[model samples]
Target chain A: MKSLKIFLLAGILVASCTNDPVEEQDSWPVDFDALVALNCRAIELRKARFATADSLRLDMDSIKASMNQSDFEKYQNDFETRKNALLSESNALADTIRLRMKGVMSDLGPDRKRVFNDSLQATLKREGCE
Target chain B: MKRILTLAIAALIISGCAKDDEPTVQETPTKSAAAKTYDADFMIDYFSLQCDIVRNTNGFLPTIAARGYGYLGVTAYESVVHGIPNGQSLAGQIQGMSAGSLPLPSADLKYDWALVSNKAMADMMRYMFGVNLNPDDAILIDNMEANTKAQLSAGVDADVIARSEQFGADLADAIYQVSKTDGGDESYLNPWQTPWEVPEADYCWIPTDLQLQPLSPDWMNNRSFIANIAEDTQIGAHIPYSSDPQSEFYAAAMEVYNQVNNNTPEQVTITEYWADDPFQTCTPTGHTFNILKQLLAESGATLEKTAVAFGMMGVAENDAFISCWKSKYDYMLIRPVSYIQEHIDPDFTTVIGTPPFPAFISGHSAEIGAGIKVMIDLFADAQGNYTFTDISQQQYGFTPRNFDNFYDLANECALSRFYGGIHFTMDNDKGLELGIAVGDAVVNELTWPKNIQ
Candidate 1:
């Protein structure tokens, strides 16, 4: 058994000398769709925000009054729920991207620092949500 | 080619000069049908014939035009859908189709006066009459309608003309029923807010079943809501001047008002007389158009043909209105006012503040947008152009510019809402989409007679 194992090792060693190792293709399943949905929700939120902002000019007091009322507060809560749903969805996408990129970090090594910063900045901006 | 180029450049230069620089003729052609007849103006909100009836110094013509104008201006868009078979209005479809999307299908919601222009008037006439006016009928209806001398000499008093027109309208109402005979459920042409006993479905913008729905006590207040007997209702009346024989224009208005009220379900009370604040500006007092269906008699469109055409347009417009209203109501989000009233918006300072409504879609934009589509179709086969010139006064027909036909009128009329401040850029965009879509569908779907074909 020892001799047989040594023979296998010797073959691997000889092959290693002559052959260049093939790069491992890391294929991780990505939920890109979650990201798309998050972005769509974000865009819709942004439009609603702008529309609300536009409403302030006519009767600021009334607008505030209406928004402050319970029904509007409920609506705001619903909106926030949707916003958080998008954030979670985006986070799931970021996590998937992270896992895939980690497996192929050697190939993406240079791309890693640049793309990671860009992605971190983007996610942070989204999370911060001003 | 060189001469044409030089002329084009010269014409451009000349046109660049203010319209005021043009020569003014002092002749007031109010009495002369040859001079005062409906010139080829497409911009006129009321038919030139109706205008002529009002312009008559006989004191009754203006009254006739005023009555007709009110009917035309306030109700004609709705009626056009009801007047015709399967004549759906663009308003309803747009309201429903574009609902919930502001950036995509948003439109303005308010009264769109452009719905009353010449194309609309002519379209109403064609749909009511069935037969397109041969040049002679167009000319005759055009000539005899306005001038005081012509109307007076035509043997009928204001009473007779009005009565005949009323009868024509009644007939139109009955004939419009034909649209529903084969249309399945969609054939019932509802021109205005029909208070659904159980609300509505499909393209219903306002869900009668919703708990948060606004109460439309005033039917006209909401584009899709019907003012019921519980609300201040406006039931129509038939004062056939021909039958009454002694009916005057002012008297007709009063009588019509009375008749409408009397017919009201015994559940509500009404004002004893119409009151005047006296302080209201003269701007609110201008005349409106009422299509004298009897005027089609002079135009040689047979009574049946006129009724059919009128009924078709009326039915279509109403259908459009209902369609639009439901679409909007179903997507009850907000109006310009709602968006305008919001306090948190930063861009509010950049704009003339919006109304108390959602920001995305415009109600007026959808209604006028779609209404104009059905209107244009009714006249697609007819002749005559549209012209409107707000001269020293806001007189539409005062301009001499020529129009090829009704399509040109619809194009320019659609833009007028922008100036009126009721619709936004995006609202107009979507409204136009729905209007054209619905109008096309109704026009194509409705069965026109083989003779007209």
Candidate 2:
């Protein structure tokens, strides 16, 4: 996979602010990080939380008609843990994206690089891109 | 002789310099006036610039403009109110007005909540997911007319940007005005009302001849798209750079839902009692769903087709509901209630009187408008060439405006909220624009491999 990427990179201009309108049209096809890593992390976090919610639903309905304070607290803690985990990972992913955009802009000396980096970072963070 | 010549030349030069020294302040005196701050005296005198700006009867231009402008509004608002998860709004005044509850504008029609809520939602959506409807994947262009930002983003003139902003704000104003008087106590622009028995020709504003035509074609078979939208929109409305899980979507959705639903009956004097609820009346047609079914039947369509249309409409509506709410919460501006309740009018309790949410824009009106737009578009697109002029009319307390097309349908949808006495003028205006924008996104983006589109 690494070798294939290198070969691909040789033919492609990764950060080129191309003047050719046709070539620039959906040219990259994918922002690789968004497609692979960020997407994967986000889904993993969601699936994990959804699974937790299903478990809690079952417990609240059937198992835990009555629960001790400690048990309730433990449940709350678990929920928070998952939430924080996702939030942290998402933030990290967003930072990574910001870094990448900054890297691209710096390479191209593009104006409004910071604006793009910041907005894109916030957008990713808001989406919880883990 | 030389001294005399030098002195004469010096005098000429000084005179020329004096003539040119006039201040460089006015850049087209009228243009400068248009750019003046309307909120200078804490009273905004928003001048309406209703030029015949090119808008498609249906397509990407207005949709992109709506989304892009909303992003701009929310971002600006958020910048103003930093740190807090949410900000303030203006729905309170509209709420009072809609209820016929507030003494007319003269007694002191404080802040307009309608405008604030609409702006808030627009801003939040952009903050969450700077949407990418133009398939070529960039912010700078409308989807149908993608300029491929690589070539165009740099070359975009400043005037185009200004025009787009004006277009959005203008659309908001028009929507707001439509809702204000449509069936409510104040509606003036829209003389015709909705969910009615027959059309009042004088009630509609759009020319008589224009009302003779039917809705678009593509919406007929695919009308069922509304019911399955959020799930389907996961395909079409998904931003190109968006990551998975969409935590922001969920978070914002939850917040918006909570904000709207959390309102206790105690807050607003209205919505506590149904206008003609089934329980209160012996009529089976009192149910909203039943009435809708009846309306569908009147169209002379089969039950299956009607059901399909409603379902698609349902999806469109739900997606819009989710979209608007999410957008609002993400941007989270204080409601007009905050401004009026604190600063302008102490007696004023907005329809959702408690004023829990900050307002900048109207999420409620926007979602309602979008849902109606989607349904109307779907219905019209399917049943092409049959104009709806003078068919259905209602005289709700807020408006009496007659509607004709999907655009008209969207206007009424937002108006109903205002008539119901929940949103302010701005809220209704912005919401309708947002709704149509969302509907447009769904129409353009959601596809099923040519077998569908």
Candidate 3:
């Protein structure tokens, strides 16, 4: 009975020791790639939103050329309100992405985190998201 | 015979549980007493984490960010100064800092300087950002400190690790006490300084955005690291505020108007790249620090060299903002958008949104000008040339920009503000001048280590 107990304990230790690498290999890449994709999507969304804001600004400028001072001021107030809302929404989205990235990255050790960041930057650049 | 079999089974269990990658506790021969023997990975990691924290934290605008960088750099240098050959403490050199301002490590004891720096940085970050630090950022900081200690603690004596950590924490506490008197403590709590009385004189700055009031109007009152640094490097008088179409002031406004209206795509790209907007990119100071980090990494700088460089740049950045802010509110010059819209073309709009502040001197220009000077001193040759591609903005979705020389890079940064139509020529030019002066003082006036081994 004692011999069996020793054999069981040794088996458990060996199994525990060998399980980590397999778990890491299975999960790390999938999670890292998902994070990279999420970040890229965030960047694209920010770009599109900003582009929309820029177009709106141009429209306001064109409209301003023909309007009287009082009318333009009123138009300007409304335009600012809309522009601010769009920017705020975009900013909030970026903040959320940052928080998510941090959460994903926190699980990694420093060296692994560096690798993940380097990969993310490369992926973003290759995809022309940067 | 049965007892021997039981002992053999125990050994098998222990051997199976041992990690193959775990380092043995034997002392490493290469880890000498010299600070330069160690790589700068620990400092680099901490500063990289700082960039994210600065970006995420609320109200860490350029001026406030510069202050945090100043204390961080000073703390880092102090944490490891004892290990550097011929290294001098920044205490007596910088203003309001006396000699023996920080705890000293015992001469007889060995220490891991990187571990010391790790602990100091961890403490400083918590103190610098205080309650504003995000929970996510706090986790990153804790992880970085733990990972660094784990890596550095291997092969080091337990006594040395404990002593080094205590000294680092003590150094941070002492530096924090010093920082409390710098007129910027808790400035982040009230960044806008609401209820400010805007000057009503002609050409005085007007609010371009309703959301932002004049930022840190009394930031000029913040104590500089170098005594009289701001007062001595004051910018000359700007062109007299004139509304006439042909006057120099009018010409400056026209120049901004023309540049924005006719800006090439490349110019617009430059404008956006250097925007260094808060909440998106960490402020301008963060951008400059990132460049320093990149350059140090490329150069493979030692822990000692990295600490000194960060300290010098930090002082220059902090003083540059104070000096620039002083000139800013002193002149209270109108931004180009306001000037062009009111005087040149009623429908004029800038390519970028104007920052809400007095615009005599471009804060971006002044801070970058100061930073580039320090980089040139450290990294450049006789002609101030250091070729490198800046990928610091890549994380912000901007493409990397290349520079063949530091001077051109500084010039481009200053010019980007002009191209953005937020700053006039005078603002960029004088801001650069002021920044260079501050940078020169940090390089020449402070007594850094003459020989870093």
- Who wins the DockQ comparison? 3
Where model 3 places Cα greater than 4 Å from the true spot, the runs are A1-46, A52-130, B1-32
Q: Of models 1 and 3, which has the larger lDDT?
A: 3
In Å, residue A57's CA in model 2 sits off its true spot by: 36
User: How many Å off is the CA of B364 in candidate 1?
Assistant: 3.6
Error of 2 at B126 (Å): 37
TM-score of each: 0.30, 0.27, 0.77
Scoring the B chain of model 1 against the true B chain gives a TM-score of: 0.35
Task: Give the candidate number with the greatest TM-score.
Answer: 3
Off by over 4 Å in 2: A1-130, B1-292, B350-360, B381-402, B415-424, B447-453
lDDT of 2 by residue, B186-276 (tens): 1111212222232223111111111221111111112122334323322122112111235442333233333344555332212322121
Tens digits of per-residue lDDT for model 1 on A12-109?
A: 99998886232222321333334334434443443343344334334544645667578767865665565455444433443344233333232332
> Ranking under TM-score, best-scoring first?
3, 1, 2
For all the predictions, what are the DockQ values? Answer: 0.02, 0.01, 0.04
Q: Residue by residue across B1-453, what tens digits does model 1's lDDT show?
A: 999999999999988884532221122112212111222222222343433322321222111112233233322333222222233332222222121111110112111111112223443333332232345445644443344223333543454345334433442343233222312212112222145342343212232111223322122232221112112211112122121224442242233233333433221111100000011101101210112231222233432233334434433333333343333443443332222223223232222222222222333343334344443443334332423211111111011112344345334433333332333344445544554444455456544332221
Model 3 - which docking category?
Answer: incorrect
